[model samples]
Target: MSALAYSQLPNHLQPLLAKFYRAHNSRNRIRSEAICWVARRGDIVGGLCLTPVAQGHFLTGLLVTPPERNRGIGAQLVRNAVASSAGPVWLFCKPELVEFYSRLGFSVANCLPATLADRLTRYRSSKTLIALQNDQRMMPMPNATLNIAIACLLDDCGRILVVRKRGTRFFMLPGGKAELGETPLQTLRRELREELDLQLEDDDLDPLGHFQAQAANEPDHQVEADVFIARLPRAVTVQAELEEMAWLEAAPCERDDIAPLLRGHVMPALLARMAQAERVACCAATSDQGEIGSLAGKVSSIASSS
Candidate 1:
């Protein structure tokens, strides 16, 4: 369908599309063959389109009129669009519409290299990209705040200690935001002591890294989490502020289990620290061995002097 014909849809339906997709601009948007189809039921009851831009491929304006929805037209339109796109296809959807796209073989993946989250931060209060699904839209709000925590540290033993966020069913790390007059380090220590009942000195706090995550457990909130690594004490006890805790392996808390910002920025830094630690150990061991050999030579020299 030509972009002109799609643009000619009834006036009322235009706002519906625009509401779900902020990118829907009737005057400015000209249709490209690169875009998928613009389906109309006699009077243009529904439409779907694909827009390819420099950042990545985005599916937009998948709309079905309120009266004609749930008759399988929307799914058919989306399926056609997905088949045409080559690279990673992404669309924004609200918390409610996650299942609808999932059933259509669209699992919620991180909007990577530049997602709605990144755009919110970059564009400064404008939603750079809005994902659409059914009646819901995952629109970006600039510099949105989120609640977050570092769940666990995957040690050499492959054990991960997942902490339950205080007073939430969703499990996360035992940490909280910085209070008045508290640095990130101070906030972490206070939170750890409050939730896990462990005392940690400054040296014990290994800066793990920070990550971007959606607070799906809460409405209209997101988080940029700063994770840290600490030596967990044996037989650690917990306090009431912590709801629950568990120790799972690395597989469950893989990058997917954490927030997106952490996956890209925070995890890389943590991995680099791990590498640095290994290098330091190797250097220390070599130095010790050299010292032992030098001591024996010194004793042999003293005997020759005698």
Candidate 2:
């Protein structure tokens, strides 16, 4: 019922992991440099390893006991490994498992990087593996670029505001491409007003950070995003300019339709901010209660004296 890092795992679990690797015929692939996540219920029930490869990180040696297979333990282990990873993550799974991984936010690539190509060949030669259909439409062309300014608007209940543009399935933070002469804030302000009919002043927006990711709408181009945080009133109505709007809880695992930048970066930052704000509010509430207690004590003393 708990997940542990490779180093934090007890000595007793190593033999179990080795057995799992042996069962998968991947015993030789274990590396000390790799990060492993082990899931345990009483004892080790499942595990997965993430090794640093030239392309990014390669996921390997995934295993779950028969009893634990359908219970989602393997999925949780993979999710934890991916969330902990800093950069791109890659994995090689059986053809049947392609849909499983795809639902976890990995696209089936027609061609892999040079580092993964050799491994793919080895895997195919060993097993009856076929190449995933090369989808040119999903592949980004070389040397493409896009610029966007995105807003991270949170409602009173702390859910984030995300908008899905017309004809696109991915729901991303509200905002759009920046104009040539506009600052990031200006771009966001204009985009919000134009896209959502929501007016924001400079004081209402807090600069979160700048990030770059594969553009959701434009294939082969990277979108450089300047992200900002704004708080929306609970009663505000969002009038969509392009398609539709929804308040999202920033939960990445529940859905795979979120934009990459938001899933990988912006959501983490927003979550951190939410935590900090909650802490501040907690401290203020405690301080206020302490002040009220002190005042109450003083009044009680005065009444007693009188």
Candidate 3:
């Protein structure tokens, strides 16, 4: 796409494209040649850039605004890049980002002998590494089983143990569906073990509550979250399998930080329960006042102690 057509997008989107340009556009050479635009409502939400060094060789860069991510935009952008380019493309990413790039038909060719040039370039500027020789490897997505998962809430020292949601940016309780060889408790424990490397005892779990929470950022998927209260034997470090994990104060409904389901529905329900508790306390106080007046006359003569 040329400048005029690319400029048609909204101002916010234009900056995203500009950022890609600034990264790919540098002092030495013209590294990027192609750009793919992902738009909605006539506004550019995402874009991908490609720089070809030779025949059947190219490097790629993808940029997407936070709000428009996880809708397969990255994959779509990569598909466009592959189709437009001639042959074996390459991309460089951190070990953690391997999965993300893998989903877009990329594989690790070499992890050893960390390139000295690449390292120095990365140290000087991140874009230098991102612009390294085009990766020729392609990784196809393997068939993966789809299943429902749930999180059981357990509080420890004011910190909450949460299972990072797979394939999304959120954390909740740690639980999932039972596989063929697993029982309910086994499945729950297994998920925790796999996701957080933790073992659980039967006595440690107490049923706190259960509710239906729609999958965050997903429309059709719904989860029957069976929340529980428990204490961890000791603090355990979270493995990288889940996106991330953290404990948040159980408070007002909000999606700014936590999962959408928790922010949109679960927190609201909990807030209502807290309000109910306050109402119950007020009623108990009123009843105690009446009882005090009735007991006052009897107390005056019933028990006179020196």
On the 0 to 100 scale, the lDDT of residue 278 in model 1 is: 87
Clashes of each: 10, 3, 5
Off by over 4 Å in 1: 1-140, 147-160, 166-170, 201-203, 237-241, 248-268, 297-306
lDDT of 2 by residue, 188-297 (tens): 89988887778889899887766666877777676777788888743444455567777787565357888888887778877876789889999999999999999999
State model 2's lDDT: 0.72
Q: What is the C-alpha lDDT of each candidate?
A: 0.57, 0.72, 0.54
- Candidate with top lDDT is 2
Best candidate, TM-score-wise? 2
Clashing pairs in 3: 89-135, 90-134, 90-135, 105-139, 151-173
Looking at candidate 3, the ten consecutive residues that score lowest on lDDT are 1-10
Against the hidden reference, what TM-scores do the models get?
0.42, 0.49, 0.38
Ranking by lDDT: 2, 1, 3
Q: Can you write out model 3's per-residue Cα lDDT over 83-172, one digit (the tens) per residue?
A: 666565655565566755664556654432234335446555644233223243443443332243344454555455555665776666
